[model samples]
Each structure stands twice: as structure tokens, then as C-alpha cells.
Target chain A: MALRDEVQVGSKDPSGFGVHRKRFVYFALIGLFVVQSGLTYTTSTEVPDSAATLSEQARHGEALYREFNCTACHQFYGLGGYMGPDLTNVISAEGKGPAYAKVFILYGTGRMPAMGVSEEQADALVAFLGAVSATGTYPVRNMDLTVWGTYREMHTDEK
Target chain B: MKSEWTAAKGFVVAGLIALLSGALFGVIGSWQHVIPGVVDAIPFVKSRPLHVSLVIAWIFLTAVGGVYHYLPKIVGAPLHSTRLAWLHLAIFIGTGIAVVVSYFMGRFGGREYWEFPPVLGIPIVASWLLLIYNFFRTANKHKGPWPAYLWMWGTGIVFFLITYTEANLYLFPHFTGNMVRELTVQWKAYGALTGSWNLLVYGTAMVVMERSTGNTAIARSKTAFLLFGLGFTNLLFGWAHHIYPVPSALWIRVLAYGVSMTEWIILARMIRQWRGTLEEGKRGQGSMTGRFLFASEAWVFINLGLALLISIPAINLFTHGTHITVAHAMGSTIGINTTILFASVFFISSAPITKNLRVGFWLFNGSLLVFWLCLVGAGMVKGYYTVLSDLPFQSIMLRARPFIVGFAVSGVGLFIGLWMLTWAGVRTLLRTPGDPAELDIHSAFLVEGPGSPAPENGHAVRQGSTTTLQP
Candidate 1:
């Protein structure tokens, strides 16, 4: 076969003459933009409503905490594993707000390894954890955090 | 003839390595269950790396050998650099040995498939670069716009380098942050190296098929090229499934699915076309390599099914980051790539076989059949219990013990096949009766009835009295 014919058969012309190729590229770009915007919007808006009493930043922080599998280790309100200390009264003990918790997470102390979570993720985790600390009810459903909520409730009642 | 010699040496080395490793893996795999708590031993972890590395080494050596033999014939020229080829051989063997040593010492970089520490990794990378440089430089001096087979091989080499670079990033000082992205990249790299390299081998197969059959129709070549291109695209983009749990946008997921589906479509089309082309008598030929090649095509579909199953958004939600993915990977690599590599070896070795060659053919095919069934069956059982059940990881490991045993059992068949191939390759190197000229003449006579004047394009062009076939 001729080289020109071979090229034509193998690849769609890049000159935007082909209607299907042009459409595909346009659609892909549009779809990418939409997904990026949607994720950003969901991250920003969905936080405050789920835990309405908490600050907007705190709500976003909560979303990050859930997404990153934090609860797999540290306990909160009798939830999570015993691998790390309970953060139920962490804010009160630190004598500060969510910022102290964020700092601790950012630069982990003693046996706690720094998880290398991004700054944004750290802030969101702090806000969410702070909200949980304030309410004393682990924000389980909002993040789909998969904590044994029933077990936590039983332990909380016992306490 | 020189190309044939090089291929023979490669076959011997690769075959020996494969047989030894297969035996070791089989023994270790069987013992892991029989001996209590042996799975937890440091040696077990070390052995896994050794198994994977040896498999990689054997396949690569075979691929290089096949390419060296076939490229010269395909391009109508002798090899550009026999010295560079020897260098390639040395680098592979030396680095492979270093990797095995490093693994046993617990100095591995600790990544699936990329376990070889940087000490060995650097040399391997250098060897690959040298190969790419040599191949491309030689290819540039040739006349034709790159043939599909050459393109495939070239692309495989280039992508192998890219994959290695991405893999090595994990060893870098600043390798912290974006765990999901890093993991995705790692899997993508693995997929490309294996998938693209498989395509390259398949391309080589296409060339051999054309040479063997004297059927270089544009349609068949185009179909092969398209399948390879589409397969490459799918293999690279389909890695998005690995990062499903990460905070990546949905577009990534969509891209992964779209590309992967396209890959399957092209492959399906190619297999359909190849099946359609198979003549009646050709189908029953006792060429062990031919049967294995046909079986490998079947495996391509099997791999496609597993790929699509895991690619499904709903299924992937559960299967992602699970042992099922590992099964899929093994199925594709061992089931598809290694099978094709062996087929290529069989094709090359056909040039010089003196004995019936059919014995080797049957042994190899039978071994592969056993290997495929045992591995697939074992993988399915392991995937189901490990992924679906809420059992502890250790309990799941216990459930997988039998499958591990199955793999070991299957390795026996693979060892037999490797030995047969080595024997056949050695015979070919010795200018045995079944070499290229003899097979070509026999096939030509089959094509054009006895007493008919052999056409110029027919296999008679290479016929010489000295090339004997003792039957």
C-alpha cells in the first residue's frame, strides 16, 4: 500500500476536517471541564450543609478526612480503631480550636507518622474533626466514613 | 543463518532460566501451604521477587532473540550491530543476577514488579537505552516507512524506557505526596511495559506469519497495525481504574473506560480476521508453536473479558485495589505475553529442526494448556474469596493456598514446554532438517502441487541441496 493510503487508514487526519474526530475532542474537553468544576463545587458547598453548625472550612476538612481513610487508625467518639489515641476531647485538651489539630496532623509527634496529606486535606480533616469534637457525635454519614456508628453510640452511652 | 545462531543462544539461555525458575517457584509455592507459617518467612517474600524477575528476564531474552532473528529477515538486511546485541544480552543477564541477589538481601525497592533496587535498575535502564538507540539507528538507515512489526517493536522499547522512568520515581528523594497519583502512574507504567511489549511480540508474529505463508496482503497488515495501536492506547489509559479511590475527576475514569473498550474492539477484530484466515489443513498442523499461538489468541479474549469486567464502573468499585486486579495482571502477562513469546520462539526454531519437531510441538502446547487452565481456575477462586468475603487478610491468604499450589503444579507443564523449545532451538542452531529451507520447500510444494515450477515468490528461492531434512 502507498504510504499516504496507509497513513489515512491508520490515523484520523488532525486538520479538523473529520467531523467525528473534531466532535470527540470538543466533547472530551467539555466533559473534563464539567467534571473538574463539579468536583470543586461539591467540595466547597456540600461541606457546610452536612454539618451546618461547623464552619465551611471545617466541613470541607471533614470531607477530606473521610476520603483519605483517617478513621482507619485514630478513634473519634468511640469510633475508629485503637491504633491511635481517641480525639473525642482532643480540642479541649489542646486548649485551642481546629488549628492546633491541623498543626499536629501536619507535623505528627512521637509514634504518629506524618501521612503526607496535602495542606488542603489537612485543613479539611481538622475542620471535620473539630466539628466532631464540638458536637461529640462523630460525623459518620456525611463522609461515609464507615466507622461502626452503632458501636460508637453504645460506648458513648456507657461513658 | 547468523541471526538463527543468535536466536538459538537466546533460546538456550531463556529456556534454562525459565526451567530453573519455574521449578523453584513450583517448589516454593507448593511448600508455602504444606509447611506451617512458611508464608510469613522472609524467604517467601524474596522468592516472589525472584519468580517475577526470572519470568521477566526469560520473556525479554526471548523477545530480543526473536527480534534479532526476525528483523533482519523482515527488513531484508543483516543485523546492524551484533556487538550491541551481545551487549544487550550481557546487560540483561548481569542485571537480572544482581536483582536476584538484591532481593534475597532484602534490599529491594519494595514495589510490585519493580522490586529491583536502583543498584540493578540503573544498569537495566542503560541497557534499554542502548538497545533503543541501536535499533533506531539501524532502522533509520533502512528504506521503507516503518513496517507494522518494526513499529510495534520500536514503540515497545520506547515505552519500556518511559515505564522504567516512572517506576524509578518511587525511589527518588521527593517521592512523597499524591499516593494515588503515584500508584496510578506505577500501574500505568506496568501496563504499558507489558501491554506494549506484547503488541511488539504480536507484531513480530504477524511478520513471521506473512513470511511463512507468503501472504502479505494489505488488509491483514493494516488490521494488525490498528489492533496494536488501539491496544497500546487502551493499556495506557485504562490505568485510571487503579486510582478510583483517589480524588481524581470523573473524566479520568471515563477516559480509562473509553480507551480500554477501544483496545478490546481492535483486538477482537484482529482475532476474528486471523481465525477467518486459518485454512483447514493448517489448523491440524502439529506445529506446537502454532497451537500455542492459537491458544494465546483465545487468551487475548479471556484477558479482554477480565479487563472489561474490572473496567465496569460498578464492578471496579469493589475490585479496585484488590487481589482480583492482580489475577487479571497475571492472566494478561503470563497467559498472553509469555505465550506469545514462546510462540515466537517456536516460529524461529522451526528454521532448523531435524527431528519430527511435532513431538516438541505437542509437548509445548499440552504444557501451555495445563498452565492456562490451572492458573485461570486458581486465580478465579482466589479472587472470589479474597475480594468478596469480609475475612481477615490472613484468612484470605489461607484460602488462596490451594491456588498457589495449582500455580506450582502448572509450572511443571511450563518447564516441559521450555525444555522442548530449548531442544528444538538447539537442533535448529545445528542446521537440523526442519530448518527454514526445508519447511519453506515443503510448504511451497503443498501450496503449488508437485512437479509445478516453483514461483519466484514461493519458498523455493532459498532452497539449496545442502539444507537437508531427515524425516
Candidate 2:
């Protein structure tokens, strides 16, 4: 078990990842995996009402988003291309409401290429953003971090 | 080795085709970013999936071929069922074709990277199960404790099934309810899924290293296991770094940050490892496989630095949505994974070094270096501006456009290099087995070390012959 012994060149490793220890490691990995899976499903994730159900128009916008490959440029919840701002709370963010989002969608901002959607389509895209915003607050800035790294705003329903 | 062509080499052939075709699509996709509507027939929307899926196919096909090829050799036995092996290939290829056609026809529902329809996932899942059954049945026959590579392969196989299934959790009503949860789960699954395949690809790298050098001890070394354990831990916990901006519980991001920082330990150990592998160290400069392995080492360092910095919460807030993330992804996939896989390909085929491969190697590496730097530069500019200036997306993109253009131009060179390399690899694979120039696995491996082929034309020759390994 000595660190020096474990690293010897071409050294015969009996307990160094030996088959005898395979079962133990395998179980440990699976156990860790199960707990993580549970945490991902139960503890860390939640849903608000507006997020739990999207309007019919928002579904259309979702489809259009995928069809346009908008994700290649924009992100939701900070998990996309940096080419554009995070759209997670764009519609609800102060000074930037649905009208502001609609104009950019309808007429291509020199920055974001015009998505070439009709006015109605732009409305739907904004609606989609509205639903996403309803999901939670992002860039979770002003919260004190607990020692365990849990956040204060697990509810994600802040408007 | 007479019967080897039927089961294993078929996958190699399919994989090479995938690599060549994928590289072509990747070139097209990159161009679209610079010149919008450049390729009308296949827009970026379609090309992205074609490139992503096909390149992914190359990795799986080749990596799976490696496992199939090496399992019997290492276990000192014939395959458990060659019929099942062939069936596995048959289904895989069959499904692969369907996936490609779906992309061409513009039928897509699945998320990014895996943009094919959700139903197509059934065959993929089913076929992988066959691999699991086949892999365990064959690999279990090894006489002693399984080497580090076996553990890697086994873990990769099992985890692919687990994480892949996890990726589809979006289909369930529970996960889809909240965009936050949905996005978090999506990336969590994908992050780990990426890790699963890395295990597969990295396992292939280690196999090529062990077999070529005839250094079984390296794969069985304690250090190798410790490294594998470390990587596994990261795969489990470090994934959440990908979704740092999501409003998920802070614990996920914190845990990932802590785990990801452990790459430093991996890096330090790797430096020590280079010193320990005396045979590889001495002969590596001369061998094609050795050169590729070394290239991967350099890439690991470069990308790990970027990945670690971005894992930091403050840095990530700016870099997460930018070209920097793309740079990291590209560095890992193309720089590290592709190079290692190519090493495995050339090593397995025992292809003699040739002019085409030499040109291909230099061009590939050279173009990639330019491409990688441009992306990082673009990412830095975009990240800084997007997070700071009230500049519209256009102004920021305009600033980044020069880098994007360079990236696209370099992509063409990269594709050309891949074309030449794929031709070399496939031609060598298709050559019938009885050539005197080529050494049979038994005879060729009897000499210690893959001493690098002097030419890329005929057979892989051993340079510094040391100990003999029993076939």
C-alpha cells in the first residue's frame, strides 16, 4: 500500500487494482452512482407551475429553437454558446420584457442573425423564453453559500 | 489471424468510412459559422448532426473494434461467440446507416450532439447490451486479476448503458416539468456520458500501448489503477461543472469544482509516468503510435488548464456560454481523443509509415493547433465582451469573426489531413493477410515493443528487440 511501491516501473501489482478488489470497487462505484442519481432526481431538482406546463405556443417555439439550432448561439440556464446572452430570464429580466425580446426575434439584430420568423413566430419564441424564466432565477448571485454548497433559493420561483 | 478479417476488421472498415465522412461534414459545419448559408443543400442544422454523429460513430466503431480485437488476444482464447460479434457489428452498422439517413432527411428530435430521432436510440441501446454480454463473456476468461484496461473497458461498457439511459430521462414528465431541471439533467447525463466514452477511448490507448510494447506490467501497474479510480471519481462528480450557471443546488457545482481540480494530481502523476515507461520513453520519438500518445499528453495538459479555470465559478460565469467551451470540447475530442484513436488505428493495422501518413500527421496537428488557438482567442474575446460590454451579439461576433474565419479555414485543412490518413488506414486494413511484409500477431508480437515502422508502406517492424512475449 506504500505510495512508492504502488508506482514502481512495471512492478507486479497484487492489490494494485487486482481482480480480488474488483468486486469491491464495482460495488462502490454503483453505490455512488445510485446516490448521485437519487440526488439528481430528488434533492437538487424542482419545478414551478408555469415551468411544469408550457403553453401550446411555447411548444412551437421550442420546436423552432431546435430547428434553427439557436442553441448553437444562445443558452438557457448558462449551458450554451457564449455568442449570445443567457436567455433563461431574458423575458422577465428588468428593462428586457417580451416586446424587447420580440423585436430582436422578428428583425435580426446585427448581433443575432435575424431568425427570419414571422411576427407571430417571434411572439412564440418570446413565450418560450417566458416559460423558461418562470423556471427559476439564474446567475444565482446574491445568495450565501452553505458549507455543504447548498443554495438559499432552491424554490426557483422568484419573479 | 486468417479468420480475423471477418469479425473485427469489418468494424475498422466501417469506422474509417465514418471518420472520413464525418471529417467532411465537420468541415462543412465549420464553414457555415463563418459564411452563413454556405452550403444550401445541407445547412448547419443538418451538418452539425451529421458531423457530430458520424465522428461519434467513428469513435465507437473503432473503440469497439479495439475491444473485440484485444479481448481474445489477452484472454488467450477464441471469442465466446464470433456469431454474436458479427451480429453486433451488423446491428451497429445497420443502426448507423439509419441514423445518418435520418439526419439527411432532416428528421430530428433528440438533443444536441445526438440529434437523431428518439426511436433510433432503441437499436443503439440494444446493440450496446450485446457488446456488454459479449465483452464480459470473453474478458472474464483472463487467467489472473484483470488489468487496469479491463476494469476501464468494463466500467465504460456498463456506465455507457447507465448514463445513456439517464440522458433520456427528459422523456419522463418529472424531468421535463422545469427547464432548469431538464437542462441540468440533460447536461448531467451528457457529462457522464462523455466520460463513459472517454473510458472506452482511453482504454484503447492503453491497450495499444501495452500490446505494442509487450509491457503487460504497465497495464497491471498500481499507478494505472489509481489513475483509473481518479478518473472514475471525476466522471461521477465532476460532471456538474458543465451546468454551473444553472440554478441547481450549489452543491452540484461545488462538488464538480473540487473533483475537477484533481486533474492536477493526474497531471503530476502523468509526468512521473513518462519517466517510468523507459521503453516508450526511448522509442516514442520514433514511433507513429508513440507520437500520437505524446500528442494526447500535451492536449490533456492544454485542455485541462482551460477546463480547470472554467470550472471555477467566477471564471465559468463568463466562459460557460462562449467559444472557450467549444475550444475545450474541440481540444478534448479532436486533439486528445482523435489523435489517440488514430494511434490505435495505425498501431492495430501495423501500417508501415508512408508519405501520405506523414503529411497527414503534420497537417492534422498543424491545422488543429491553429484551429484550437483561434477558438480560444475567439472565446476569450466573446466571453469578456458578452459578460461586460452592453454590446449587441453582432458587435461581439464581429470582433470574433476573424477567429471564426481562421477556424473555418483550418477546418478544411484538418479534413484534408483526415482524408489522407483514413485512406492510409483503410488500405492497410484491406490488404489480405498472407503478405511476407506483414507480421502475424503471434510472430510480430513475439518481439518486444512496437519499435515503429520505418516506412508507412508494408509492415510494422520492431526496432529495439528486448524480451519476447508468449502468444
Candidate 3:
């Protein structure tokens, strides 16, 4: 095929600045995505003991979590549903612990229907949550803002 | 048209089927939220994934199908290999069947959007490779400078495979063993995956617009590519906004917040051009595509505004994990993407503006608006009570019940409207012959060439007159 007869990229612009600029922007953005992904992976801090090998019981509770779709109402790290409160630090938070979570799961609350999970399942669920709580906190409410637009807790051990 | 184009049509049919099935499950899932014991056969757990997966399938299948159908036409060549396209379709349909079966059998292991067994992901990756090979081979033939839509499609196709693979990385223990890394990687993949597909869908919208208006300058203009660049950039870095509440590094959240705010450029552009677009819509009253393009513009305004508001860390404090988040998702997926795809489907099928379709269009949009508002209502109640008052989850939900009921009821209307549109699309796809003359599909609706007279309505219509197409 004779190439000159065809519309080449930037053909619409006699100056060709638009085409060059766009290509520059596109490649630059792709590079940014790669860099961000790398930084996120390398710098991310896991919950304490979150990387520890999971116990068999905790694994069972994990399965129960998905099977019942607890995520439909509850969130971890503030990512799931809004109907329920975040469970990220619930097990470790003041005035709430595994025992507090267990009662609601096994017997249900006034508003939340009983999940009908067995007693053993409830224990496993609490164990799974305990493991998650060991990972991190939620709501990121400590608004220690830096000049660079980040919370102080994100970079420091202020919490 | 080549027989290869028929394969593209097959994907549309498959996508529509998935759309209806997904909507059915969506309705079931919503009602289940209200009446818990209503559908015991398939509980909310099963129904939610089925809804999410199938709808996601519809977007991919149709957007990719549009790419397949248009790529050769735009490139002025036949597809590199028809057999490969069919192979891609076959593999995808096979994978879909397996996914549904797995869901029904209560087998799930992957992350949120991809709740099916992890093993099924293999075929998906393989099928995508076939598409990549076929796409580049054909698209490379275009002689002129590649248009914005071409770049959009290329970026979308290549990045979808990349991000999708990234999403499944959790199957590796290294990623899964750490909660922070796991959550970060999961959402990283999801946000990009969504952006990749949006590029594809938005590319289709651009092509449809260029062809309809016969405006070569539109796609080649500096502003268009600039917008594409901005969108691409946001896709790369803005995803972390979805996870600000996660105790990830501060840099990720800061970078995403900046990236997300850039969308105001697009919103401003839309506002600047609003008058011209409204005039265009008035002139295009006779064209369903014109109407749809206008509708998409309005949705982009509303959705982008909401998106920008929620992207802020301060506002996100209340909105994260709330129904407001769902509202944002719905606004983008249904309000924006669905309308754009509908326009493309009508353009390709040459379906007419009939009374029934008009009713369906109004019903879908009207119901969706209400549905969106009800979600915002529910989220406001929940976000306030949960954040400020420390109410129990059930207590907040109890207060939000009326809105929830409204959402569920309106969902039924949305489904019915979508069904009517889908049925009409199916008929058009089945009946329309492969017209080789229609290879230059983009220009089919152009009414602005030299010596071309506008219709008596003083507007450009589709290539074939209204009388040529069935209502």
C-alpha cells in the first residue's frame, strides 16, 4: 500500500504538534501507572501478622466469610458494603472484641437477621476477624495532614 | 460485509442474553435485600455475583465485539484471521458457561468481582491473547494517522489483559498472605480493568459520533487526544481513590486524589459545549443515536460531578462503602456506559425510533434516575448515622428502608426497559444481512458531504433513511 496517500497520524495537523504531544502524554501516563503500581507494592504495610501463615481454622472461617457473603453488608479496610460497620479493627478496637462480634454473628442483632452460623462457625469467624484486625485499622480518621496531602499516620507511627 | 462481521454480531447476541440474565439476577438480589426469605433457591450470595459477573460480561463482549466489527472497517482491510475471531468468541462463551455453572454449584474462590473458581481464569486469558493478535494485525493496516478512537481501542485491548492478569495475582501466596498488599493489588487491578473497558466503550462512542456527524476533525482534534491522554493517566493513577480508607501508604492516596481531580477538565469541556450539543440534539430528534449521544452527555455531567466529589478524601470519609458508592458505580455503568452502548447498538442495527423504544428509553432513564437518587438517599442516611451517631448497622438500614424499597421497585422497571431494548436489538441483529457496501460504517450516517442535502428535518440522519430501517 502506498503510505502517503493514506491519512497518517497527525495528518489533520499541518503543524503536527497535536500528534507529538498526544503520543508523549500517552506513553508518559503508561509509565506513571507502572511506577505507581511498583511503589504501591513495595511500600505497602500489611497488618501485623497478616503475612503469617494462616491456621487451618482461620482458613475455614475465611471460606465461611465468602460463602455467607458477609462482604455484602460488612467491609474490611473500608472496601465492602455500607450496611454494616467496618471490621478492619473491630476485634482490636476499645469496647469491642471477638466476643462482641461473636454474639452478633451467632444470634443476630435487632436489625441484622441471625446468620444461622453454628457455634463452631462463629468461633472460626471471630478467629478470622482477629487475624484481620491484626492487619490494620479503618476510617483513617486521624486527619494529620501534611503539606504533601497525606495523613501523618500514613508515614509515621503516630497512631 | 465479510462473513467475519457476522461473528461480531454473534457476540452482541451473546452479550444481550447476558444482559437480560444479569438484570434478572440483579432484580432478585435487590428484592432479596428487602424480603430475605423470598428467593430461597438462589440466595443473595449467589445472586449478587451472578448479577455482577454477567453484567460485566455484557460490557466486555459488546465493547470488544464493537472493536472487532469496526477495526477492519476503519483500517480499510479485512480482519487478519476470521478463524481466530471465532475462536475467541467460542472460548469466551465456553468460559462464561463454566462460570455460571460454578456460581450455581456454590463454588467461588477469587476476589469480589470475580467470584468464580480461580481455574476458569485460564481460558479468559488465553482468549484475550487471540484478540490481541488479531486486533493489532488488522489495525496496523490503516494508512493515515491513527485516530483517537483507534488509540483508545488499542489501549483498552492491551491494558485489559494486563490488569485482568494483575487482578488474579492474589492466587499467588506472596500477594494473598499479606492483607494490605492483597487489598491494594485487588483494587489496583479492578480500577484499571474498569478504565480499560471504559476506553473501549468510549472509543465506540467517539467513532459513532464521528461517523454520524461526518466530522473528521472531531476525533483528530487536539482536544480529543488531550482528553484521551487525561483519561489514560487517570486510569493509571486514580484507582487508589477507591481505597483511601485502607491503611496504605499516604503517597498512593495523595497521588490518586490529584489524578481524580483532573476529570474536572472533561466536565468543564462538556459544560462549555453544552449549548452546541443541545442544539445538535434538537436537530437530531429523528435519530435515536443522536438522542442517545445527548443522553450520554447529560449522564457524564451528573456522574462525573458525583465521582469528583466522592474522590476527595474528606468526602470519602463518609461515602466509602456506603450506598453512595453504589450510586457512583451505577451512575457510571448504567447511566453512562449503558447509554453509550445502546447508541452504538442502535447505530449498527439501524433500528428505528419507534413508540415502544421511546417508551422503553424513558422508562429506563427515568427509573434509573430514581434508582440513583434512592441510593444516594440510603447512603446519606447510612453515612451520617454510621459516621456521626455510631448507630448499629441495622439501625441505619432500618431508617433507610423506604429508600431501599424504592430502589428495588425501580430496579424492576429498569429491567423491563432493558429487556425491551435487548429484544429489539436481537431481532435487528438476526435480520440484517451482511452488507458489504456498509464497510465504511462510520460514514453511513453522514449527511454533510459536498452537495449533500440535509433531510427535510434539517438534520443529518443515518446512512439509510428512516423508511429503510424497521421501527
Candidate 4:
């Protein structure tokens, strides 16, 4: 239970990860993790619109999304299955909007199976997609790459 | 007969069942992808989560069970508490049932990969806490400086609690409010969560090697410790590679790429070690555990290379969200993790490796090889067109259907192989502990355990069932 006992109990033997060094490495890594997690939870979150939060309708839509397990096939930020296109910016993409997304939700495409959503449910899903698109882009085709293999726009506040 | 070893065997049996059923669901899910509207009763949506959760259960159950069985021997002490261990198992299985029922009833509200009701997480988390307490208390009794595996297990036990809880952060309004934050945090949790389990699994692998070969120095070696340190570092930082395409901060993505490159070191070490294992491996034919361990080494070589390439941003731009990711995931979970677990399972049983077991081994690996390649081929095609061209998803998927069908057909072989293995694992675990074949493991006594030769360890000396020899 004691930190000393936990870190240095068996460490009575010398050489190779012992005493002071082991304790130092362990605590330092834990400290770094804490710092990284904090920074990630707070300052690191960058989105196009600071004001674009999920609405009540979108929240219900998110629940519906989970209930139907759309993530099993579709993607958000290209982080889901390969069966469907990335829905991150689908609502705002040219030639695709609320109606287009709604149709697909209501009656599935040839490859994409229908989720059996009603019209009201379709409207909510479109709202969820709209809010998601407002947050940021995916398949970000622009290539202002840094020499160190990072996208240039990720660090900027620019839209 | 207060045989605590029975509790450990129980976990192994449960794990094997989970694995067999999970692989069955996986086979169904694969076929469903190729031909839609099949298995309408348990659709792809339901089957996918069932497969994922059950396979995950298999990993956790067997790995934790290994710890329970082996720790007392390593420490030369009685386990801190058998009651708590049983309690942990009870809660876990109960939660698992609830999860299954919820998914069947279409009552899910959790994130991807963990789509069960959020409330079920409470018992799961509670059980993990019992494991953490029980692990530290027993492991703290270890004599001398702890081995690399011990450090690995301890870190894994603690972090599973941390990251599993972190996974639930979406319950808060803040995390769920914005898409960018939700995606970033979700993946961050998932990445480290995987690392947590990897520690448990890799630790068990080291223990199995040490016990099988009677090489105590393996776990205590500088090389082993160095590898653990590298793995730990990567678990902490390498996770961001998953989100390179997402609009997270540049540092997050760049750090992931840097950390992921560390696997090159791991690969080089494993290859060097494999040369040494080559002759020993030829003699390992009748040894089911030995065969599985060797297979895992080969898998690690394959997967680690695939993982490293995809971690690169240049290539990741093409591969990030494709079947390539699925391939990597499958390669790790099946090729590496599952093989390691099979080795552990067969090791615990000390079961005589049979002709049938050998058949299953080849069948599983052979099918998995085809399964892995099909995913890679499909990924390569889809990633190319999806990124370089503006082809719709339907068109691209059509191009990839041949591979999906290949993947589905191979999955049947994979399932048959798993069924054969599960039969062997369960049969051996259910055998009378005092059977002649069982005593060879402890009689070898390179390390402390069930039939530990040391008379000072009162519990194992009395418990003759754990004396099963390492075949």
C-alpha cells in the first residue's frame, strides 16, 4: 500500500531497474500521462465552430444511431467500418443535404441497408450530421503538410 | 479438497467457450457483410458487437486467469484471497450475460466496440477493481526484484481500470457535446485501453515461455525489461496514430507516428530470438502450447510490420479508414493475441498435445493467413480509390467484394479450427487434476506454482492437481 513498499520492496536487489531509478521512471510516466490527458481533454480540442454543440434533436439522433449500430457500417471521421462513406461532412457536402441524407436513412442505398428509420427519425439524424459537419471536415483533401508529417491546418484556428 | 486451482481452470473453460461462440458470431458477421439481409434474426449490427465483446472477454478471462494461477507460485506464497477472485469472476460473467441480453433486445447506448447498455459497465468496473486489489496484494509478495512480466501485469491491472473508466467519459455532457472532442477522446481511451490488455497478454506470454523452456532468466533479463519499457511508452503515446485523419492537434498525431516506430525495435528482437527458437521449436511438435507460442511469434512479426507501415502519415492518408485498419486489428487480435492465449490455455491444461490438436493448429493458422491477406487486398483497393479518386462507397465496395467473399469462406475454416481447439482446451481443463499427465508441469518446477517442489509453500504442496507437467 505504501508507495515505497510498492516501488522498492523487492528492489532490495541492485542493478537493472532498481530503487530510485525505477520509482523515478514510474512516477514520471504517470505524471506525463496525467498532463497529456489534461491537455487533450481541454486545450487540444480544436473545432471549426466553437458554438456547434449537439442539439436535443441531435442527441436523440445520436441515441438512435447507437441503437441501430450505424457505426457498424458507417464512419465518423473515417473511424468506423468501411461499408459506408465518412458521414462527418455528408450533410454539407455539395449535392448532399438534409433531404438526400434523409432519403438514405429512410430507405437504404443498394450497398447501404436501410435502418428502418421513420421520417421524424430521419430528420433528427440529418440534424446530427449537420452539427457534426459544422464541427470539422474529414477526408481533408488539402495538403498543407508540415515537414514533420503533420497537417498544417490542424494547429490553426482557421476555417 | 479446497483446490483453488479449480477456480483458475474454471476461467480457462469459460474463456474457451467465449472464444468458440465469439468466432462463430464472427463467421456469421463476415458472411452477412458479403450477402446482406442474411441472418435477419441476429443482423450484422447485433452480431458484430457480440463477436467483438466475446472475443475481448476471451482475452481478459484467460489472461487474468493466468495471473491467478501463476502468481502464487511466482511469489512463493498463497494467494491473497480466493474469495475475491471468485467474486471477480462472478461479477464479470453476470455483466457479460446482461450485455448479451441487451444487445439481443436492441437496447444499446454505449460507444462503438462497446455497444452494450452503459449501466452494465458498473459491474464490469467493480470486478476489475477486485482484480487490481487482488493482483497487487499477491504480486507484492514476489521475491527479489520483480521480473519484467510482473511489472507488465501490474501496469496492465491498474491501467485497465483507468482507461475502462476513461472510455465512459462520454456520459458527461462535455465529451458528448462536440464531435471532434468526442472522437478524439473516444479513440484516446480506446488506444490506451488496448495497450492495457496487451500488457496482461504479453506478460502471460513471457511466463509461458519461461515455464515451458525452464528459462527463469527470460523474464528477468535486461532485454525483457527494455521491451516492456518500450511497450509501455507506446501504449501511452502511440494511440494517436489511429486518428491522423481526424482534425485533432498536430502534436497528438505526430507523437503517435514517432512512438509507433518503436515496434521496429520489437520486431528485430523477436526475429533474433526466433532463430534461437528454431531448433527448440522443431522438437516442440507434440507440445500444443509450444506450437501456439511459435505461431504467435510468426504472427507478431507479420502484424508488427503491418502496424508500423500504417502508422506512417504518408501511407495512413490512404489506409486510415479502410479495411487496412480492420486487417491490422484482426492481425493483432487473431494472429498475435489469440495465438498467445491459445498457448496459455494449452499451457495451463498441461494437456498432452494430440494429433487432433496439431490438425486444429494448422487449420486455424492456414485459414487465418488467407483471412488476413484478403483483408489486406481489399483494403489496398478501397484505400486507393477512396482517397485518390471520388468513387462512391458502393462502387468501391463492389471492387472489394471478391476479397470479402474470400474472407467469409476462410472464416468458416477459422471457426472449425476454433471449435476443435475449444474441445481440446475444455476437455483437458475438466480432467482430474491429479491425473498422471497433470503432474509433469509442477514436477519440472523451474518456477514456483501448483505442484511447486518447495515444501515451504504449504498450499501448492497439498494441492497435487496443479502438478501437471509442461508437455
TM-score of each: 0.66, 0.86, 0.89, 0.91
Query: Per-residue alpha-carbon lDDT of model 2 for B263-366, expressed as tens digits?
Result: 88866655555543333434555556766776777787778778878877667766767778888998988898888888887777767766778898889989
Flag clash pairs in model 3.
A7-B144, A7-B145, A8-B144, A8-B145, A9-B145, A47-A135, B1-B435, B1-B436
- Tell me, by lDDT, which candidate is best: 4
DockQ of each: 0.04, 0.23, 0.32, 0.34
> Model 4 chain B, poorest ten-residue lDDT window?
B456-465
Compute the DockQ of candidate 2: 0.23
- Output the number of the TM-score-best candidate: 4
Q: What is the interface RMSD of candidate 4, in Å?
A: 7.4
Tens digits of per-residue lDDT, candidate 3, B338-401, equal: 8888887877777777888888888989999999999999988877776666566677889999
In candidate 1, list every pair of residues with a backbone clash. Answer: A58-A127, A61-A124, A61-A125, B288-B361, B351-B435, B351-B436, B352-B435, B353-B434, B354-B433
Q: What is the lDDT of residue B358 in candidate 3?
A: 88
TM-score, ranked from best to worst? 4, 3, 2, 1
Q: TM for chain B in all models? A: 0.81, 0.92, 0.93, 0.92
Please report how far candidate 3 places residue B326 from its true position, in Å. Answer: 0.4
Candidate 4: tens digits of C-alpha lDDT, residues A1-159: 111111223435333556467668877988999999998887555564464578889977887887788887789878976556789878878789888899889998765667678988888888898888777766756556667655556423222
Root-mean-square deviation of candidate 2: 6.2
Models, CA RMSD each: 11.8, 6.2, 5.0, 5.9
Q: Provide the lowest-lDDT 10-residue window in model 4 chain A.
A: A1-10
- State residue B447's C-alpha deviation in candidate 3, in Å: 6.9
User: How accurate locally is residue B101 in candidate 3, as Cα lDDT from 0 to 100?
Assistant: 93
- Report the TM-score of candidate 4, chain B only: 0.92
